[model samples]
Target: MQVNINGIETRYVLSNEGGGPWLTFIHQLGGDLSVWDQLAGYFRNDYTVLRYDLRGHGKTALSREAFGMADLSHDLASLLDALGAPTTHVVGMSMGGMIAQQFALDHPSRVDTLTLANTFGGTRPESRALWEQRAASVREGGMASLVPSTMDRWLTPDFQHAHPEAVEPIREVFGHTLSEGYAMACEAVRDFDVRSKLGTIRCPTLTVAGRHDTGTPPADTQAIADAIEGARFELLDAAHLAPIEQSHRFAALLETFLERPV
Candidate 1:
């Protein structure tokens, strides 16, 4: 379904399931709501799962210029308000994780629990350099140039070799992405630094890390877990897209976490 959030037309798929708390899935950079398809079924039976394209992604309209993390967080807040979701358990991956952090900081009362997967709390020099390279490449060659590199980070060699079906959809997503939207997201990541403020997050938190992830290493997850008092940390033997590559384990962990008493 579509809703106007802060003047931008946002497209979201809301699961009609009732009786459980609402769960929101936020995808990584260059990704849309479809990225969560692999794990959505696991939650659909119990919870109201809301998956939507971030601003400037999928069917969501972009702003006139580039955006910051705060803007993205506000968009999320607007989405929750429009949906009349009093509170939600937010799960975010990579760049989405950064936005989730900011969202929790900005709208504490609206968030029930927070999960950060394959994400970073701040911009490290190495990551900054990589983002710069990707930004440059996207500007010059468009989104196609991002495919091979992104694929390498997203999936393990064995999984890639075994699942040929996954490649085409990923390629389609990459090919159809707007360079400007991606570049703007990269700039948001470049400027993001919330290390000092992570302690402000009061919601119960979980941090999931992909052991083989080069984009946001296990150390990043550890940092997030440590920063948030009593946050649970789990490491999966998968690449960056752990939710896709290890859907069962991811779903199980999330189910266990969300089902726990507050």
Candidate 2:
């Protein structure tokens, strides 16, 4: 469950049922590997699903020093090597997407395909203060205080009202998140900028966007698709956490795209 990787103890779950190409899933800022549990089960019959907690979230240890996207990306790479996986398909959402892009860019040969969903290549310059504000909020009120506003941003009101139970995991996981880890990661997400380098990623890529997601709007996701040659973009009828809100549809799209392209 935990491996000493890149000088940090990384917590991960590797699905046992599937033995095909490794399909690594990364969670958003506040979430851990469980963020992908639903999709991992869906793909476990065919693909080896590897999901893990980022250094500061879940049971994984926090970074020893101030970190960057590259540091986070390398954590994924090293974990795969430790697991003896030579290459893998990388799927990342939100903050995880930034790390995935960094992984694909920094270690192109190791990435079989890239799936960026409900994420952006970078935060706008004007949003720097906003990121700091979030960091402050978490530092002051902890994750519990962020649940309501975050839920509003992640899930639409209708979905929250219709299926309140579904969003509870996020609340629970997020509530328990380490403030230091959250703040460290928030700063990383805040200062992250990979837009100029998105063009360098040559792997088969798919970008998914939540049409109603204001956090990372359709335009932002489309820019990533536009930058990456031959990358495909799909718009889903959900909010920021599209995969959780529209799990079946997102899974169907991912399944179709990942089918051996021969």
Candidate 3:
């Protein structure tokens, strides 16, 4: 459940069912591995599902020195090495999607398929100030300050009213996030940009966008698919966290993509 990867105490779980190729899930910023609970459970039947907390979130420890997206990718690389997993199909949402792109570009050989959901090809210029403001606000008021806004952004109003239970876990994860870790990760995301380098990704890729997701618009997600040689883009009728809002549809889409990529 916990292992030291590149000196960071990373928390991760690998399912033993089927003993098939690994299907790894990476969560978004301010959240932990649990964000992929339903998705992981769905895929565990056929693929060896892996759900892990990023370096600065959940039970994982952050680095003392400065770091970047590449360092996070290195952490993932070391994690697979520790687990003795040769290759994995990576599915990432929001910030996790950025990490997947970085991993695919940096360590191409280790990734079998890349599925980026509700993510961006690069950090937009306007997003820098927003991220900085959030980092400052959380550092000052703690993680609770951002919960309301995050929930509103992640889920549409209709879904929140219809299914409060589904949103509770995400709220808990984001609210309980360590301020230091969240701020540290904020910097990583603030400085991340791989738009120009997206062409380097050689693995079969899938890009997903939430139709109502304002954080990463559908056009942005489509651009990512366009940049990659043969990536496909799909749009879902949900907000930022489409997988949770429409778990069955997302799972079915992913199942098809992994079974027979085009």
Candidate 4:
């Protein structure tokens, strides 16, 4: 389904449509709502699951103006209002994690629980330069140019070799991503810096890190957990895209967390 949000047409899917709490899933850079297919499928039978494509990515209308995290957060908040979802359990991965952090900060009343996976709170100067370079590259060569390196960064070599079928979907998603959207998201990531404000997050939070994820690294995720009071942190045996690379385990962890008392 599609909804007019913040003057952009946002594409989203709301599963298990019955009345109840909602589990909102946010995708990483170069990802669409379909990126949450496996996880959403796992949870929809037992809980309400909502997934959407951020502006400029997937089927969502691209924005002509450059956007930042604040814009993305407003987009999400507006979507929830449009759907009349009073409050939601938010789960975000990678770039989505950064946006989730901002959303929870901006609209604390609407967020029931916060789950951040395989994402960083901030980027170092060196990493910011890398982000800039990658953004420029995508703008010049399109999403295809980053696929080879991104695939390596996202999944383990063994997983890539053993589960070619699993990797193809991710590749297709990347291939379909709009270069302008990807580039703008990269800029948002480059400027991401919330380390000082993480302590203010009052919701129940879970931080999940991939043991083998080199992009964000365990340290980066740990810092996020450390900053958030009472936030639980766990490490998964996968790479960046743990929810995809180790879907069952990731789903189990998330399910258990969601079921915990408030």
The TM-score leader among the candidates is: 3
In angstroms, the error of model 2 at 44 is: 0.7
Candidate 2 local lDDT, 89-183, one digit each (tens):
98999899899999999999999999999998998999989999999988887888888788899988889889878888887888898998998
Q: Which segments of model 2 are wrong by more than 4 Å?
A: 260-262
Q: Clashing pairs in model 1?
A: none
Off by over 4 Å in 4: none
TM-score of 2: 0.97
Tens-digit lDDT track for model 1 on 33-152? 988886777788788899999877888887677788999999998898888898999999999999999999999998999999999899976567777777778988999877988899
Q: Lowest summed lDDT over 10 consecutive residues: which window, candidate 3?
A: 13-22
Q: Which of 1 and 4 is ahead in TM-score?
A: 4
Name model 3 segments beyond 4 Å from true. Answer: none
The estimated TM-scores of all candidates read: 0.95, 0.97, 0.97, 0.97
| Per-residue lDDT of candidate 3, residues 1-262 (tens digit) | 9999888899998876877888999999999998887888888879999989987799998778767889989988999899989899999999999999999999999999999999887888878988888788888999988888889889999999999888888899898999988988888889999999999888999999999998788898899999999999999999999888989999999999999986
Summed over model 4, clashes come to: 0
Model 4 lDDT tens row, 1-262: 9999989988999998454589999999998888799888888877778999998899999987988898999999999999888899999999999999999999999999999999988878788898899889988989888898899999999999999988998899998899989998899899988888999999999999999999889889989999988999989989999888988988888888899923
Better of 1 and 3 by lDDT: 3
Tell me the lDDT of model 3 at 237. Answer: 97
Candidate lDDT (C-alpha), each:
0.87, 0.90, 0.90, 0.90
